[model samples]
Target: MTELTERIERLAIQDGTIITAYHALSFVRSSDVSEPVPAVYKPSLCVIAQGAKQVLLGPESYFYDPGSYLVASVHLPITGQVIDASPEKPYLSLQLQFEMDQILDIIQQPYFTENTGHKSHRALVIGQMSNSLHEAILRLIRLLDTPEDLPALAPYAVREILYRMLQTEQGNTIRNFALLGSRAQRIVPVIEQINREYTEPMRVDNLAKAAGMSTSSFFSCFKEVTAMTPLQYQKRLRLTEARRLLLATMSDATSVAYQVGYESATQFNREYARLFGQPPIRDVRRFLGMNPQ
Candidate 1:
């Protein structure tokens, strides 16, 4: 492990809910990062120091380990699996949530800058990690070890981290989310619509209309906002919820499938197996074992 990572892990504790520190800090650890957990990744900067993880945004996938860092510029319902980890080398991560206020403040300043006009990228990205960025993350994590110092110094440290991200390949990713009229702005309403009506049978043409473009333009922008197409976005949501219901209650594959709007149990099972690496019953069984209450 790097010196900075070692120091950060020394200070974090697993409280179950996302750990909120003096300046929005948390250190993530697991004995063996084996499977993906269901979670909504809000706009944030998540850096990994050790081990590796894969995030599925719809049908598309992303992996970030020591070699890369992740940035989620919009709130996205995602499936993330830790692709690499072991008892001796567990997964370790540091995540810092972003605020539009911070980005807006930065842009209003004299030195703030970017060349993001008419440019667009996926809302989430896994780019090659840089040594400078790594060191900055380490510094942010280390502040947690010194609780006394955290009270007076954590805010400045957090700002430094944000400032560094604003100046990297992540700059446009951050700016579009904050500034109005960026492609990110055009897609926010459409994304919210999908999240709200995930349980219903959705029509791509309708969503394309809501997003205010021709079917082709909407499809292009939607794919850019989410890593996958609209149908893929809804599919993940269905499977994820079906898996949740099967675990939370005594529901068979058919019932669980219906609960999430599947027309056929056979189809649901096939898709579930494809996504979670097992059929409904077996996958739920494995899921329960891993997360038994």
Candidate 2:
């Protein structure tokens, strides 16, 4: 626990990006009850040290407290809030990103093998953090203490961390994605296409063609991987972005609706209230502490 704290603090100094450590990495300052914010988790692992967080992956929800980590093998649109955090003992967390190329290399290693049967058919998963994986993470963070070593050693440490992850019991849960032609592997292209064209109206036939699957096959596979229909996934993405624009830019409700692809402002406001428990203006105002009319 103390090691986790020391590692994050040390690594933070060397990290120039808003991200304190690496491309697929982020740190929490530790907080209590964070103001709800809108965003999505890409292909990354989320680890918590003190409190808990709830991640909505489509209709299903997942929660990970201390001693646990959530790995998103693919970039899935999600809604996350640090439902638990406080200044006294803010929920501390570290997020590590995973990429297909790197995971492929790891999967190719002869010494490291995998069994697909146990691997999650779903893209996102929660695994208990083991001492080996946690300690490896601590070591990577410790590298921040020696600045010169970071350039030469950080990459190696990152790989080793990936190796440790591959060795875990549920390691197979995440390793399957990197292996080419797996069903989960096939879902990648479709997910990418939706991510890029999320703002546009989707054509099921075109998307299914792009995914190289019959419409029926595509629908089944997409729903299996994401637990939602394609359009449902798009709706979540749109609403998440609408919330972001309103919160960040103080954009008006009608404008936010249009920007997010809603055809009618009235429909947008109705859906926003249903999804977020309030109309766009009210939700944004409460989140940003702005005066309400």
Candidate 3:
């Protein structure tokens, strides 16, 4: 942990998330506990170098610290908060986003063999931080100090980290996310479509057709992989986007609500408060430290 912590601390010189030269990689540092931030997580490997955090996927709560890492193989709406941090020792973490094609390419390698009998599960998984994985992450972060080395060597380092992940206990679960014709694999398209079209009205039957499953089977399997129904999934996405818009710009709640596919400002205000523990305007203000709710 010393090596990982030292490297991340040196690179993360600020108190917010930073996207590095490696396009798929990002680093986070926060000096204090953060508000429960709502967002959609991409398919990525997330490692905490110091402190602890909690990630909410639907109703489930996942706690991880330096000893464990979290992986989200499918894009899903999640609420995350830094549960443990202080001015003396801030929360430090890294995220490496990967695409489905990359996972498929790796699985097709001759050295890799498919695990036929491994059953599929939810997209969000908590995995042990193996020694090799920790070392790989440290090496990846060390590249930040050398700008020239990044263009030539960063890909290899990133690929090595992915290889290490493939050898971990959660490898099969990650592999199943991209494996063709698998139940979870079949649902990937639906998830992507929901993310792309969250602002549009969605019909479950249409989504079921996209996944090539009947409505009942699609509904069941969707919940099995995402832990939320189709409508619930869309609502999460909408609310998360609304929160983002509110923070990023000066958009008011009603306009942001309409932009995120809400038909009624009354319903939007009601659900936003329920999910965020405050009204949209107050939540944003509390997050920005301008006002305390």
Candidate 4:
């Protein structure tokens, strides 16, 4: 294994995720391939030091490994799975989360050029990893050993990593999401609104007006970035939350369905089964059987 991979595996130690002293950074280790797990991914850079993984955004599948990096510029509900891993060489990776303010700060630097066009782009992107970017990430990871230096030096190292990322080919797309008044930026608030009020009845006209776009334009741009319509996005959010509630509490399928804003138990069952490949109760039972708490 490469030194980078070895260092991560040593630090990870366990099979799940480890939040480092640098709160924005986290390491993940998995010893075997996994089923597709759904969750809302925040804005972050994901790099794999060993093995590979797949991220499903709507119907699209994104695979990345040591040679490449994946960036989620916005919060997105996605299904992720470790596709290549084993106990001997586990899937080891790190995620560095950042805010739009950080990207905006970098864009203001004289060396950085702001793209003027307002075309909407996919929120999730994969780019070829450069040597400089890799080195920057390594430096950041090494900071875990020197906790004293981390308080001061971690920011610089993280900044360098972002700087190197912005120099890549997909950098322009990343910048567009953070650019002021851009369509992608405008759509962000709508996404946030959907996330905040997903249980409420959605009106396309109101959302379009809030975004300052026409109905057709809003629909096009929203789907362009999220790969799903606004209604579909809300449904996914609802079902995802329903699953979480069912697993974490004593609520039955019917109760959980209503809790997540489903008006009809029958409709909820049909939709939940379609997404999870089994009825709610059966799926929950299977999950609990596999991972007993």
Q: Whose TM-score is greatest here? A: 3
Model 4 quality (TM-score): 0.94
Who wins the lDDT comparison?
4
Measured on C-alpha atoms, candidate 1 has an lDDT of: 0.74
- Residue 288 CA displacement from its true place in model 4, Å: 2.2
Order of all candidates by TM-score, from best down to worst? 3, 4, 2, 1
> Where does model 3 exceed 4 Å of error?
113-119, 291-293
Give the per-residue Cα lDDT of candidate 1 at 11. Answer: 54
lDDT of each: 0.74, 0.77, 0.89, 0.90
Stretch of 10 with least lDDT, candidate 2: 9-18
> On residues 180-288, what C-alpha lDDT tens digit does candidate 4 reach at each position?
8999999988998998999888999899999999999999999999999999889999999999998899589898888889999999999999998888888888888
Can you list the residue pairs that collide in candidate 4? none
Q: Total backbone clashes of model 4?
A: 0
Better of 3 and 4 by TM-score: 3
Tell me the tens digit of each residue's lDDT in model 1 across 153-257: 877777777777777766776677778666666787777777788888888888877767788888888888887888888887788788778878968889889
Per-candidate Cα RMSD to the true structure, in Å, reads: 4.0, 2.8, 1.8, 2.6
Q: Model 2, range 202-234, lDDT digits (tens) per residue?
A: 988788887778999988988888888898888
